[model samples]
Target: MLIGGILRDSSFFCIKMSAYPFFYPMAFPQWKEKLLYWADSRFSYFALTQGNEHSYPQNPFDSCFFAGNKELSENDLWQKRAFKVGVLGYDFKNQIEKLESNNPEFFSLPDLCFFVPELIFKIDSEGIYASSRLSAEFLSEIETQVIPETGSVTCKISPQITRESYLKSVQNIQNEISEGNTYEANFCQAYSGEFETWSPIAAFLRLNQLSRMPFAALFKAKNNWLVSASPERFLKKSGSSLIAQPIKGTIRRGETASQDSENRKKLLASEKERAENLMITDLMRNDLARVSKTGTVRVEELFGIYPFPRVLQMISTVCSELNPDTSLKEIIRATFPMGSMTGAPKISTMKIIEREESFKRGWFSGAFGWIDESGDFDFSVIIRSIIADSEAKKLYFGVGSAITIDASAAQEYEECELKAQAILELLRGN
Candidate 1:
């Protein structure tokens, strides 16, 4: 079954297979030597629906993985149908070199990495589909491999910054807001630990099961792995339409249904939360306006509350019709290290982030997703993720919230804890 299209004999071939429950986990071992990437849209109702119809807007594949052949340079990324998988690190921002602090050498992921894959597998409501430069014989081999059972994983981790230090940083950011240095800033902290026994695939599956987020992904580049259960979309491009969904406000789920309803109401009614979301929404609108057609930028959805297993989030969607002449590089440069990850008056707020954040964000506040043959792409903000370096036996993740003048240092600390709870549970083998 030919998918996408027929290429030359030396190019990729396509096939269709019956969907198997264990396809994702087993594919890892079979393609151990290749750069593997998997993105799953587990909760589609929130991201894929508009009005009464369920349609994938910027993403064509609801769930898919790519086995890459070689890394591609940034200049080569926008070639027609490049079909690349990669990530952009938070340090991609300008004047990153001015920051005095950095993540330790073990967490030194590159600022940018994208690969041209030789094999692709897409799973949808129908079944599994494959496109590859490999032979049909190899494709059959993948189908017959035994599915490995999920294994246990355990680790001990500690926050890089003490609670007092975190609170102090928040206070400093609030001071900056008050002094007119910036309206808001995102201050982040890290947790680091050594793994006792590691099973990357198992840990990823467990995390995916626990979060069941819309933009779940597993990315491997050599010994480094990024297992993400992110619920926020950084950006997307489909035809002339460009969209970005920024998540600003978060509240933990309640123990009971009535309590959960009350909490949602409280989040909706919050003056501080609304202020936070509004500031970033305006930031995004201004950014998108740079590359957008004249007078085309607008906010599509404002303060839309969405639920996950552990928390409910306030997400606002901003969209614009792009200028036909705009290039991929221009689009990214205009709206990256997303506004929610930074803050209002982006440049000054980012400087505050660099000075106040405990460590370099690496890929934490960056993005990961695919660019398809049509030149359309979709990327998720790299939050709620674990960055593991097997060679160093080290694993770490970063979490933060936007701090405005009215922010409470103690309450912001609690918000970070709520964000880290899933990864903490996974590390403890809970």
Candidate 2:
């Protein structure tokens, strides 16, 4: 039998079992070639109940892991029923212009890389299920391997930009907003450091434990690793329906319950924050409209506040229905480098970003997710992430906030610091 152009015997073989404690610890260290583990924290506060919730069927495996595979190019992603997992870099937006830069490259990763896995694990409330093309005896042997104890790692990292420089950049963007050059721009800064001795698996586990974000993921390919605790979903395709959740506003969580309620109220009522979110929401709608069926583009949820462990974010959901014939490349071309990251007036803002940002973003603002055998896919925006090159013993992370006309330079700087807090604590071995 043949399925999706691959022999059925070579396709996934699945087994259902109770959740095992050693699954992550045992698997992480061995699958250094390619591994991706994604978790949806299922936090109580994230109640996204609007827009096609009942109309569209949901994907069964929201939380899953992929291991074992060879790299596939972006061109291969659109093949019929091609099941692959990968990351898309922000530099993919360079197709708009022949942009050139002299900034140093912290992690020399490709713009796009995908892989076909021989093993897959899907986790849900029901339990954990394992699927693989490998022999069952080999998997049984993996189950018997001993789990290693966690190790200590030390890191010293600093922002690549000074406070004065960051504030100056904010003022520059505000000036551009005033001049109608762009409505809003997401300006980012990079932090780079070296670690004495490190365990990539342990570091990711620790980071995931602290953040507990809804879109948490750990992906390793060769010497490059992406440990992400992102709270935003860039895009999801289910059947003919497409969804985008873009986060635009941020405020630190209050210490007390009452203070937290007050902060949420402030974020919801603030004119500036609302404007920032509205601009991006509109941009997303337009982007989807470009590739969607007529009359199917709509804003599902606007300015919905959601809470993570460290902060509260204002996220909006926009959805559309695509033609069955739409290709992955076409959808990405219409909406790559998501709106929340690029700002309003995407092309113009991207040009400004290329000029103003101190370093190349690379995969920082890109997305990571999987494409199923049925061609349905989901991806999360790459924020609140640590990108590392183990061979060089060097690590880098990025933090930024949207800048608008009414934005305060000092407050925006503080916001960036707030966003960087979790990863900073992780690096300090807290």
Candidate 3:
């Protein structure tokens, strides 16, 4: 199966760019390696945390750097695509830097802009700066093979822990809560495997069919990779304006309109949900404040509900006027790690995250999107994603959530499943 011109519109940047080839969530690490090997420069990749085994790494397909007025925009500029549309989002800071070094062609620009999807899905290094032919067919070589219906996975986790062990962690978290250590702490696990023929691109096509999300991405960074069908917005930019949308509250989708309405109302009223949403909003506002003009940051919309196939979410929009003096690189540096994933007191949350979690997040919770010549950039948090490193014969899906005193383990587990639904569908041979 050949999929092309899969452009991703950054709900954050309010700007549109094309997407290149896509993948299952697990292909990221290998893809990143390949991207680094052939490319001539380094770049940035952002990934996001959805909850448990679901996150992505965000990387630029085509990027040009900026140094105060050395703009990337030229009348003839456009996106580039390749045989494999390379994607990278999510973060393992050390891991990302290594990825950039490996893919010399990957770019991390400060104050520059380009179409992320176009670069990954439809454009190429030679055509990256060209004015026309940003179409997917013009860039990538997509191939598909027909295989017999194999509905079951032949493999399973190694040294598998019993349900008792998995259940033990929950009990520990409960213990922590009882001890006043933390109300809810995100936890994760990994399952790796080999695929005689598991194409992430194929998985993505099937996944997209299931979710039909308006915005999605499939990226590969050298050692880690990500494929996502995310419907969440982390941030966006236009001209000199910046905006952020943080998703917090959620309720599963209902079978009927009345049920859905009732669920939405409940999300609106839930104090735990509201508190999580509000805290992230404040964190984002503060993050934006670093690059936005003083006193220009404000909440444009609070507690807005966006319904997805599996669940309902409460998202809030915050906006700020950009600082004329702010450099593009600085803007990103200030907010590379969004507030939604880290929780309030971001640094503290991060330290806790690092200490409590078992593996490095790599690109999850990082931003992915494009930046243009006009100094306009757009990015999305990598949620609802799967990570793949085909060479390692590894496929990993994760889930996580913010914890407060009010969080319920059972409900949080359900939320984790909601986040994992799309990828799981693909895995089930949708």
lDDT of each: 0.73, 0.73, 0.53
Q: What is the C-alpha lDDT profile of model 3 across 1-430, one tens digit per residue?
A: 1113323233212223433223222222333223322221232332221211222112212232111111223222232221112222444333312322122111232212222322332222232332223344423322221232542333232312233444455566556557755534444433334455465545554565677443466544433456677666666776788888877888888899999999999999999899888878888899899888889999988998877667887888889999886765567666656677766566544544554445555445565555554556556676666666656656655566766656765676667667767766667654
Worst 10 residues of 3 by lDDT: 61-70
List where candidate 3 sits over 4 angstroms from the true fold: 1-192, 220-225
Tens-place lDDT digits, model 2, residues 1-430: 4221222333352222443222323343433211211111111011010011111222212566555546776667767555677788888777634655446788688888777665455544233344323344444444444444534444898889999999888888888888899999999999998876666666666776677777777777777778788777889988889999889888889999999999999999989899999999999999999999999998888998877788988988899999768988888889888999989899888878777889988889998887766667888888998888878888898999999887888999899989988898888866
- Model 2 Cα shift for residue 305 (angstroms): 0.9
Tell me the tens digit of each residue's lDDT in model 1 across 145-205.
4444434456888899999999888888888988999998988899988975575666776
Distance from true position, residue 220, model 3, in Å? 4.2
Question: Any runs in candidate 1 off by more than 4 Å, and if so which?
Answer: 1-61, 95-106, 124-127, 131-140, 143-152
TM per candidate comes to 0.84, 0.85, 0.66
Cα lDDT for residue 402, candidate 3: 69
TM-score of 3: 0.66
